[model samples]
Target: MKAIVLEKAGGPENLHVAEVTKPCIKENEVLVAVKAISLNPADVKPKYEDEMLSMMYGKERPVILGWDIAGTVTEVGSAVTNFEVGDKVFGMVNFPGIGNAYAEFVAAPEAHLAVMPSNVSFTEAAATTLAALTALQILSGKINKGDKVLIQAGSGGVGHFAIQIAKNFGAYVITTASAKNKDFVLSIGADEAIDYHTQKFEEILSDIDFVLDTQGGKVLENSAKVLKNGGAIITTVAPDLPEGVKAAAEKENKTITNILVHSSAEDMNTLKRMLESGAIKPNIYKTFAFEAMADAHREVEKGRTVGKVIVTI
Candidate 1:
């Protein structure tokens, strides 16, 4: 089997395609012949940091990085009954840990896998897993029609999905992006697009019901100012609340919380319904061959990609 392998955390130069052993599955897992994988900013950062890799991937040599995958189930475990050998499935496998998806095959737990919507292609389904799930989980149980929601970096993978998901819940989506992607973000359902380079979002926007922060640091901190009293923020980029955000939120009677996305079959199936109904659409900015994993990483690292970047096997 061929897989993209890495040793030590570093740059794109550390990623290499090599022949490796195929993975075996436990009774609760299914073996998928991977057809597509999505590249994300998260995928790049952890691989370049030793501490993160050790904590996330468990100090494994020849670490395989990636979580989003769409493929067909070629083999099913003895305990699995919801799927068979020929099922087409996609999901974010074992998030907050190694998924080992950047390869020709993935051993995913049966519960983590969802049946792929017939109307969706493998590439599109592959791109939908991690980013879409992050967006979905972040917004769940917190939105109502006509609520004001701000999603930062609206052109990036999670941001794009967040915009569409926010819109589906009837929220008024406000987003931040560069001048070049302002229209693109709006076209994807953001009711308002703030030019981050030319405008300060915190200064102009206020009374938000919910904030989804993808860019950490200043962006996450500033978002605190706009929330209405009793509102809440969900941030994925930052490990903890920005230095003073918690205090400010407390003062204003608002809430700020950090999130790490987890894989859920239920969420993926909900997205599948959205995909089939045209309620939400995935924006795949680019797709690369499996051999070009390094190139895909480089593009995602640029922070300018307008949607999901896919690597196809």
Candidate 2:
């Protein structure tokens, strides 16, 4: 089998296409002939400083990196019953150890897979898993109708979905982007768009009910000022809540929280239903052939893509 392999974590230049052994299916896993995969921040993060990945997975060499996948089930485990060999599926595999996705095949656990919606294209479905799930979990059990929500990096992959989901929950959504993306963010249901290059979001937004911070650091700290009393701020970019963020939120009588996205079959099903019903749409900024995995990672590192970037096998 041919796969993109990385012997060590460094940069995009270190990725190489090479012949490798095929993965054997486990008792609770299904082997998928991958048709498409999408790039995410998770893919790039491991390539730089992933000591935790090495410690947990004990991966020695020739590591494969990718999670978001859309493919057909070519082989199923003895314990699996919900899906058959011919079923079309889309979902995110677990990170690190199970990440054999940037190749022709991926052996994913049955619990991590979901039936692909007939109306959603393979590319779009492949792109939906991680970003949509992150947005869903962050906004779930929090946002309310008529509430004011602020989403940072609204033109990025997760931000676009967050804007739409918040809108679906009947919130008045405001988003931050450059001037070039103001209209694009608004098109995805943001009620107001703040041009980050020309205007300060803190100066324009106030009394917000929720803040989804995709861009961390100072943007997150500044966001606290605009929250109404008892409002909540959620972020995915980092684990720690900086003292400045906590102080600002405390001053405004608000809460600060950090999030790490976790994959689940149930969340993917909800995303599938939303996609099938035309309530939410995925924005695919680009697609690359499987051989161009390195280039895809490079693009993701730039952090400027308007939406997801996919790799087709």
Q: Scored by CA lDDT, what does every candidate get?
A: 0.90, 0.87
Error of 2 at 108 (Å): 0.8
Residue-level lDDT of model 2, residues 1-313, one tens digit each, is 8888888878898899998887899988899988999888878777775585476345677688778899999999999988899999999898434567788888999988899999988899999988989999899889999999999999999999999999999999999999999899999899999999999989887889999998777888888888889998999866366776677668867988788888788888889889988878999998988888888888888889998999998
lDDT of 1 by residue, 1-313 (tens): 9999998889999999989899999998999999999888879988878998898888769799999999999999999988899899999999977899999999999888899999989999998988999999999888999999999989988999999999999999999999999889989899999999999999999999999998778788888889999888888866366557687789889988788889888898899899999888888899999988999999988878888899999
> Where's the lowest-lDDT run of ten residues in candidate 2?
49-58
Q: What is the lDDT of residue 133 in candidate 1?
A: 92
Candidate 1, residue 2: how far the Cα is off, in Å: 0.5
Q: How far is candidate 2 from the true structure (C-alpha RMSD, Å)?
A: 1.7
| Model 1 spans with C-alpha error above 4 angstroms | 239-245
Candidate 2 steric clashes = 0
Residue 35, candidate 2: how far off, in angstroms?
Answer: 0.5
Error of 1 at 58 (Å): 1.7
Cα displacement (angstroms), candidate 1, residue 171, comes to 0.7
Best by lDDT: 1
